[model samples]
Target: MTNATAPLDFIRPEVDRALQRFVDRRRTAFDDPDLAAVLGTVRDFLAGGKRLRPAFCYWGWRAAGGADDPGVISAASALELLQASALVHDDVMDSSDMRRGMPSAHRRFEKLHVDSGWHGSAVQFGEGAAILVGNLLLIWSGELWRNSGLPAESLASAQPVFDHMLTELMNGQYLDLLAQAHGENSFESARRVALFKSGKYSVEHPLRLGMILAAQSREAWIDQVCAGYGQNVGIAFQLRDDVLGVFGDPAETGKPAGDDLREGKRTMLIARTLELASPAQAQSVRALVGDPKLDAEGVATLRTVIEDTGALASAEELITTYVKEAVAVLDAAPIEAEAREALKALAIAATTRRN
Candidate 1:
């Protein structure tokens, strides 16, 4: 189902109001007219995301019995700002020109280069501009969190979780880069990447941070439970993304079909395919995987080969396993019955999402 019709659609509107305020404040800080363009880029990048991270933060606070405090709202909104920073950087790293069916921040800058007839290499200009904008978003995210009207103790308690999330994200990005370079997309390696990159930051840490800010007495146990839930949901999310990358309709996904094959992403599906392929099939798959020149027909061939080897089924099975485990974790948590049921629904929705 579309996010507009999803159960949590109301949360997105609330978050959007906060985000617009944040963006206005951001634009007011700069005196240079050119900087307005930069701020506009940031605004565009922040728009249209699923806002899943912030929603998780909100739910975590509720699960811990936090009141609907303004501070909680601000803190949750900061998560989306942080996510925008990451996505801008990630798009640059991935050499992705388009995001959410529009030019990425870097690509927009590059296009301005050509449109304005600016001197120098557009590629370098775009990369440099996008990096600075990403940094700005990161800094503002921290500022939002610090100024969220939370008590000093609450802020202090949540700081470490936020810090570790960013650190882990960087480390996870590095691991993904290394894995890509070394062609080492084993199941174990992919699991680690998912945990550090998406699981912790995308799900667990956000939840834990909200819980910490709420000053829940069972924070320790809750953190563990959140981690387990995040691990399962995060991996499931990534696996679905991989499937979408290779097999989804381009019109719906807003990404080129087989983009992952073109980028040579060493996903779990690819790893499993290689492990289970017959000798000749394995050789054919290996030859096509990292070749930048692999065409649409080649990608289709590879997809068929992968499916024939049962890798697709294996990946789907793993997703089911993780989702089941995550449900169990939530079931055992000490949350209020109503909040627990809502959290369970969220878990199911996140893991079973089609887009």
Candidate 2:
């Protein structure tokens, strides 16, 4: 391994440029009056995202000895489009009002409805519009992937990964909904969601897709490395997110603190806290766990309870453990030393980042 500032530099500009071109093409091709508004909303949602998945895809391809070609860049950009579609829908499902420092897509549409004095339920209108827009992005993503100009076999090899990624995302969402509804919150259950819903698609699958696109012959090894890497980074990423949902600054994370608590997210932190709490502490946490009206003081108290019960430290320790494991996987991957070093840095950055 050699010195590298970050893997981000390799793909950020490429993905951005590709996305801009795609968006421009959409605008020119679609003459609908709502096109501008839709594009603007999409642009806003995509503006400040870390673009981590696309970067992973790009590096995965490069690490597999892929050339810096237009097809590979476009394929990575398509992954970003798919990610945007998922987020737009995910925010709506979560009833989240903010994302990436702006109103969520549904919220933005709802505001537009109210501001224009449009008839009917502004909330429904916003949600409906956002759903349609998300579907459109999904379609565009598919089109981009199909037209990426890779060799026929390479394109064919990459298709299953794309399909499987979407399936895992949907399954994860379903698991999340079920856990919330049934109050079946447990550490094991949360870990299941984290691995399937987030870890594989967000980190592992993207890397695998990139490798496939690069025509790697050792597909099984690539899968193993990416899975190992993804599991560690993905779980760590969500654990960090669980922490941020409680302790992160609203301005930095673009969401109010304790939002997860309010939503009663069955995250590992919450699960561990519940497990570790005393009878009195357990009752206190259970009483407030799913309450939407939990006040700032109540939220503060819950935070203290979690910390005092050692859940916070436990989650942090898990994050540290996973990050180290991911680094080890990166070290073992049969890639150029430079690529391995970049991936190690990425794993550290992804796990340790505050937002």
Cα lDDT listed for each candidate: 0.80, 0.83
Candidate 2 residue 120 C-alpha distance from true site, Å: 1.3
Clashes of 2: 0
Off by over 4 Å in 1: 1-7, 216-218
| TM-scores of all predicted structures | 0.94, 0.95
The residue-level lDDT of candidate 2 at 144 comes to 88
- Candidate 2: the clashing residue pairs are none
lDDT of 2 at 198: 76
Per-residue lDDT of 117-154 in model 2, one digit per residue for the tens?
98999999999999998998889889988888778788
State which candidate has the highest TM-score: 2
Global Cα RMSD, each model: 2.2, 1.8
Highest lDDT: which candidate?
2
Give a tens-digit lDDT track for model 1, residues 230-326: 7788888788777877888876766667777877777777888888999998888888887777788999999999899999998889888988898
